[model samples]
Target: MFTGLVEDRGTVQLLEKNGSAIDLTLEISELITNDAHIGDSVAINGCCLTVVEINSGTLKFQAGAETLEKTNLGLLSQGDQVNIERPLAADGRLGGHFVQGHVDGVGSIKSIDRDGEWITMWFEVPEALSLQMVPKGSVTVDGISLTIVECQPATFSIALIPHTLEVTTLGQKQIGSVVNIETDILGKYVQKLIPLKLDGFNERQ
Candidate 1:
């Protein structure tokens, strides 16, 4: 699992189609490269990808057909900046909420409201995914964990501090830009357990 905390931004070097999979290569800073190894999992734009190779200062990752269909990763081009984060270590501090690096849905920026140093971004969630959002809840957008400022039936907004804008891809986000979103893991579990609990109650009755 990941913590949704971006360690550094990596630049896409190449994207190649290899039959049923896409090979992604990224050039990252030494900080990530020194610790990176083949087979290690890294979260790139909220999608968990396995490192397949590390050669000449570039790390290679593979994305399958399912990932390409479900995430914004397929839209990546050479020179595009992607948020990168290593998986949370067993004893690492939990800087953000639990992020599985599994993109739950793709959301688009509906509007961007700037208030001096603070920017409030409103994203339109899919009808199927909107039910998971709640005001003040945690949501991972392109692998950056943020708190929801407001939640509507089909949309949610989050306030981004200047630091967040400077460090991550949110700085370049514009209206209509697609982003990977992962709703709160706890909320998903609760939703899943509710029906099971209700069924148990009916059986006891």
Candidate 2:
């Protein structure tokens, strides 16, 4: 599990295709790699990837066909910047909401509206994914935890502070740019349970 807090921005060094999968290598800072291990789980663009190899200041991970099909990582190119975060520790502060580092679906930038230093970015997402969101809810976009300012049937808007724009990959995003999205886990469970409860109530009536 992760807290959706980006620790550092990593640069994609290489992408070696092997059959349907790929070996992804990223050049990150030693702050994360200092205590990192071979099997440490790192959230890269909100996707939980296992560190398979570490050399110098780079960490390597393998993305399978399923992961590639579901995330924006498959669209990554060499030299692209990716948000990176280590898994939350047992005693770590929950600065952000619980982020499983599991990408639910891919969303594209719909529009970007700037208000002075703040930004209100709209993203077009799948209807299914949007149904699990609500205004003021938390959602992880490209591994950055942001609050939903407005929720539509197939889109949502988020207010980005200047700090967020400066630190993460969202700063460089453009219209139609795809991003990995993970809806709040709590919302998913509630969505599931509500249907079951309603069915039970209808049967009793």
Candidate 2, residues 1-205, lDDT tens digits: the string is: 9988899999999999989999999999999888799999999999999999999999999999999999999899999999999999999999999999989989999999999999999999999999999999999999999999999999999999999999999999999999999999999999999989999999999
lDDT of 1 by residue, 1-205 (tens): 9998999999999999988789999999998999989899999998999999998778999999899888999899999999999999999999999999999979999999999999999999886677787888899999999999998888999999999999999999899999999999888888889999999999999
Model 1, position 159, has a per-residue lDDT of 97
The local distance difference test score of each candidate is 0.93, 0.96
Error of 2 at 11 (Å): 0.3
lDDT for 47 in candidate 1 is 94
RMSD to the hidden true structure, all candidates: 1.1, 0.6
lDDT score at residue 96, model 2, on the 0-100 scale: 92
Every model's TM-score: 0.96, 0.99
Which structure among the candidates has the greatest lDDT?
A: 2
Clash number by candidate, in order: 0, 0
